[model samples]
Target: MDAAYVFAVRFRLDPDRGVAVEPETFETRLRRPADDPGESGWLFFRDNLWRGDLADAESFRGLTADALGVLVESVEYRALETDREYYDALREAIAADLAPFNADSVDEVVSKYLGSSVEIRR
Candidate 1:
């Protein structure tokens, strides 16, 4: 099984750079293994999130702009969608990794990074 961190992005093409198109919107997903919560490269939440939201919207918009070659106007955090089995593993991993963080429990860590945006699907 796999999980995805999903987001909604709104962007526009720069007229100076190329033929300008109308502003557009789309949903994007960064996919990962459902069970591998401790994978080093799977630290997207830790790196990009703060208190359940993007740590820096301007930086995120810049990254999106570069990736899509457009002017990113806005970004909205959606949810971390995964299965119940994987969610359990992720909570366990968060508990193990809690030593270095300021939180005292896995729930705190999850709340800090993901908040109410976690969706556990069957």
Candidate 2:
């Protein structure tokens, strides 16, 4: 089955300041793990919403823990594999999760919060 994976890292706001800034703070590039390709989904989505099932939740958790070391505090694992009919459902799930942020739409939210743009890797 063709599948997709989304992984994210969240940071607590600097308490001294009232504003929140989400930056990619944990460094995994130094770790010499041949298999680890550090991909972050939090910054990719303007809303930082996730909707999917994990193929192997425990294994994913372990990989994330190993990559981030002490900084990773919690993780949510999901599994989802959908054909044509369920695509809208997945989108709805994403929207519902993002409602709390009062975003007019995902694109607007992502553009504002994603910070630096990424180069697409084919």
Candidate 3:
């Protein structure tokens, strides 16, 4: 019963790019306990998300206990797709939730994740 943590955070770019979806969103995929069904596949959705793999719910709770004092405004979390249905379940859920907010088409999601931008990387 493999598990992972997904984080969705909202950030504001110093120089506005005229994009409607704020600055940029970052998602962190991390491995976690396999038997912890209580809080398996935790997904953090927040203004400034801070999520990662932890031993137990207590560990996860402790991480967010203190504010990092950045531009972060809020944080949200939930048990995402479990190991059994992780394949399509998590992928579909992410698409469905991010489709409306993404600036580019759904097909480009992967490319965007890889940091493929109009400006070529040297």
> Which candidate achieves the best lDDT against the true structure?
1
Better of 1 and 3 by TM-score: 1
For residue 32, model 2's alpha carbon misses the true position, in angstroms, by: 13
Of the candidates numbered 1 and 2, which has the greater TM-score value? 1
- Scored by Cα lDDT, where does model 3 land? 0.36
Clashing pairs in 3: none
- lDDT-based ranking: 1, 2, 3
Off by over 4 Å in 3: 6-84, 100-122
* Candidate achieving higher lDDT, 1 or 3: 1
Q: What is the C-alpha RMSD of each candidate to the true structure, in Å?
A: 2.9, 14.5, 15.5
- lDDT per residue as tens, model 3, 20-90: 65434433333323234223332332221223222244444445433332343333343333454442443
Model 2 C-alpha lDDT per residue in residues 1-122, reported as the tens digit of each score:
12232344442223345665566344222211111112243222322323333334455556666765544544543222233333343345446566654668655443344322322222
Q: TM-score: which candidate is best?
A: 1
- Clash pairs for candidate 1: none
lDDT tens digits, residue span 1-122, model 1: 46777767877555665566554444454343433677765668777777767888889878877877877787766788987877888888777778766789988888888888999897
Model 1 bad stretches (over 4 Å): 15-35
